[model samples]
Structures are given as C-alpha cells and as structure tokens.
Target: MTSCEVGNDPFLITADQVGKLSKETRVSQLGEIYKQDSIVNRRFDSTYIFGGNEIEIYETSGNQLLRLDPKTPGDTASRIGDIRILDPAFKTEKGLSTRSTYKEILENYTIKKIENTITDAVIFLEEIPAYITIDKKHLPTIFQLSTTHKIESSLIPDNAPIDQFWIGWE
Candidate 1:
C-alpha cells in the first residue's frame, strides 16, 4: 500500500494494485531499481484515433513510470498511473525529490510562477492536495497524481512544457 510509492510522500496508486503487475513484474520492478538511465517505451495516443491507445513508459534515473493506459477511463485498464520524478535520487517520504535544488525547493515549499517558461514551479501538497511541478532548475518534474480532487491550476497550460506534465482522471 505504501511501498508502491515510486518517488515519495504518500504517492499511492490503486486500481487493484496496478492490476497486479505480472508482465514480468512490470518489466522487472522498475528495471531492477533504476539501473542507471534505463529506458523503455510503448507509447501511443498520437492524438488518439483508436489505433492510438497504447501507453507504457518506464524511464529510469529521471524516474518515470506510467505503466499502462489501455483505454484510460478510470485508469484501471493498465494501472500504475502517473508518476514523474526527475531523479534526484528518488524520494518522497518527505525527503523530497528531483535531486532537490532551486534553493532546496525554496527552503521547502510555497511556490508559484505559471504562464509558460517550461511550466516551472507550482507545488501544492498540504497533505494530498497534490499538484507538484518543477522546471526552472528546481528539478522535481511533475507529480499530478490524480489531481487530488478540486484541482484547477488554471486547467494547467501555461504553454505546456516540462514534458507536458499533466495526469488526469477528472
């Protein structure tokens, strides 16, 4: 329940526990614990037309694990939902992540600066009000875990960069 949290702090994922892994332990448990700059891809949605349905990425070092998305809906179709950690030695149990810089996350939270420029800084996690992001060298790249309900960061656009960081279930 807790351990599945890939990068840190209560980053839980349900949908029947990623639909019970199995595809060789979801490609060998994060590629045997981030085997230094690992990478694998099976992406699709080339603007979704039916033939565009697949989605199974698993990067390493910079940490990304969007396991599945067969049909998207409530996200049980493939499980392992969204998670993006820009490495920083991977953390989250309050240890933070994305190698934590930018003055150590502005001395630990309270950030906002939207309207383009790589969509930098917009963290908001006062206990599961999730909406994390970082780009202007702050590192921690996106953690939009299911919006945490009531999310409305201006519908998250600001010129969409930082690898298009936006996971949804709304």
Candidate 2:
C-alpha cells in the first residue's frame, strides 16, 4: 500500500483541506484625509490630492499629483511630486466603483507629440481623469485631461487601442 487507499484518490481532496492552505496577504493600508490652508504659497496646496485614497504605490518616481488645501505659516503649501494612489475607483456613469482597482493610471504608457501643445499619449485604459506627461527624468510634469459625458461603467479597462471619449465639443 503506497499510503493511498482505493477510496481516497487525488479527486478525493476535500474542500476543508483547501481552505487550510489558503492564507491572507497584506495588500494596502487606509489613507487619512486632511483639509487645511497654505500660508506660504497663498494657494491651494497640491499634496493632499496627489496620492489617491487608500492606495499604496510600489514605485512613484515619475508620478504627479495636485495639492488640495491651504496651509499656515512655514508650510510648503503647493507641490506636485511623486504620489501613491490607493483604492482608486474608475469614474463610471453611476459614479465611482468601489470594486475594481488599478495599480497606476499610466503603467506602461507611451507618449507622442502630435503637435506643439497637442500630444497623443496612449494609456492602458480610456476616459481617465488626467493624462500624465513625463519629463526626461521620467518624472510626471504635466497632467492634462478633458471632461466628458460619463458612460455607464465606461472607464472600465478596454482592450481597445484608442479611446474615443471626449468631454468638450468637437
């Protein structure tokens, strides 16, 4: 007997045993929200809104985010720098979804300058809130996007090449 019984074949593996092998791994952490004013730059600080909510980033060398608050004295008010976005919900017609998640907006993006100010950047998904532009150092410097009519769950990742969604009139 090779430690195998006739009734207990490979197919006899129970669900409870499978459950025992399952383990949980830590993915991300919750983010804290803040609202304040900036006294240094006298403008709405950009650090608050830079990193998305509750999302942890593995690498943030070329990411960018806009500040979202004011500050008091001796405070570096507005700054656009590398950020981490957690729990990013794609914009859907019914509003943002709490289910689907993405690591980064432009994970493997490529940019081509169509014109001087008008550039064509290819992103993984379409209907993104902003298109991030990277510099020679691969640091995101410019972020541009247009507003458009929200399609029902339209922001879902489509395998399509180019996105035809537009916010303003043609």
Best candidate, lDDT: 1
Candidate 1 structure quality by residue, lDDT tens digits, 1-170: 22244323323222222222322233334433344434454544444454433334444444555433333422333433344433344343444454443344345544443332333445544322234554433322342332223323444444333322222222
Local distance difference test scores for all models: 0.37, 0.22
Worst-scoring 10-residue span by lDDT in model 2: 17-26
Model 1, residue 78: distance off in Å is 28
Q: Which regions of candidate 1 deviate over 4 angstroms?
A: 1-38, 45-83, 86-95, 98-106, 109-121, 124-170
lDDT of 2 by residue, 1-170 (tens): 11132123211212111100101111110011111211112223266644232222221343222222211222333222222122222223323222322223223322221111233332223342322222112112232232132212223233223222111101
Error of 2 at 69 (Å): 14
List of clashing residue pairs for candidate 1: 7-91, 8-92, 9-92, 9-93, 88-99
Off by more than 4 A, model 2:
1-32, 35-75, 79-84, 90-121, 124-129, 132-157, 160-170
The number of clashing residue pairs in model 2 is 16
Per-residue error at 129 for model 1, in Å? 21
Instruction: Kindly provide the TM-score of model 2 when superposed on the true structure, using C-alpha atoms.
Output: 0.18
